[model samples]
Target: MTTHLITGAGSGIGAVLAQRLLERGDDLVLLARSASRAAELAASYDGARTVVADLADPASVEGLDLPASLDSVVHAAGVVELGAVADLGVASWLEQLTVNLVAPAALTRVALPALRAARGTVVLVNSGAGLTAHPQWSAYAASKHGLKALADSLRTEEAEHGVRVSTVYPGRTATAMQEKVHAQEGKDYDAADWIDPGTVAATILHLLDVPRDATVPDITVRPNA
Candidate 1:
């Protein structure tokens, strides 16, 4: 069984992804900021382990230690604070960057030892905003742009070691993060029109199923209605 490490396993796509992996007989290490939710999910999987780490605080991720032979990693923990650029608070902006960009990069760096050993893959869950911008989404777009760049660069840097990097850019998934921002903005967006979390989770699993010789550099999924 392959050992997979996932960040943001508390809810949304992360929670669904954890369940999918567990059902497929993958050993897992779930990293999240909430202990209660982590424990709940851990109990459902036979070999699932949980680590409480706040991505906003980089130091929190530093103390974590995973097996030196992890087969895969999914960086799904992210934040989206929507508002006019001028109204964006410094603290809110920093928190977005810390969780979406800095923490993922830091965790990947720390896990390089194990990834290289297993010739594992790194999966980054980015946003369509990272590719194209829109109003009231500056912070989210900027952080996702950074994540995209990091994923691209890491792909080249780690390729020689037989490690692969894959990135997924999904448009408006039905996640709590999306719902929270939608509620705050009062935009009344339709969740049914967005990509499905289960479908996205299946995509991640597909990437994992690909033969080692195959590489899916980047993929974007959007609902068509």
Candidate 2:
């Protein structure tokens, strides 16, 4: 059975992706921030395994217990706080950077062996902010940009091992994150105006379904409307 370890499976795109994978009868392992979250995920996705690690503290990701082998590791969990460069506090920057960048790196480093054993794929669910930075998004964008760099470098380093790396940049998805972003922007949010979480999740599923003979390096998804 193909096995996948997913972060951010509690909500939004990650949650939708987890459900899709489960519906297909795939072996699923979810990364939870706490024991309570793990229990919730277990109840939500029966037959799925869970590992606890707090992304807010990157150090927590080190030496985490994981499956012996995995077909994919999807880094979908992230945090975002919006404020001007001059207004954003150091703690805010560190929080976003730790949860969005450092923790994923730490977890992926630990999962490399399992990924290599399965010739697995590493999918980083980035943001459009990763590509182009807007005002009040300095910290979050910086972290995402770093995430892109991480994927690019890891792609080259892991290629020889047949491990693939991909980064998906989804724009304004109708997830809780989007709601938060809207609130930060002080704008009204309508789900119909944004991309559906399932759409982004489907694109991720496509990356996983791609033949071994070919690989997708980066994908950027935006709402048509």
Instruction: Please list the Cα RMSD from the true structure of every candidate, rounded to 1 decimal place.
Output: 1.4, 0.6
lDDT tens digits, residues 1-225, model 1? 799999877777888898888888888998867678667767766578988778878778786878879899999888888888999999888999999999999899988999999999999999899899789899889999999999999999999999999999988898888888788788786778777898888888889888987999999988786
Q: Write the per-residue lDDT of candidate 2 for residues 1-225, one digit (tens) a residue.
A: 999999999999999999999999999989999999899999999999999999987788787888889999999999999999999999999999999999999999999999999999999999999999999999999999999999999999999999999999999999899899999999998999999999999999999999999889999999898
TM-score of each: 0.95, 0.99
Candidate 2 residue 82 C-alpha distance from true site, Å:
0.5
lDDT of 1 at 79: 82
Model 2, position 35, has a per-residue lDDT of 96
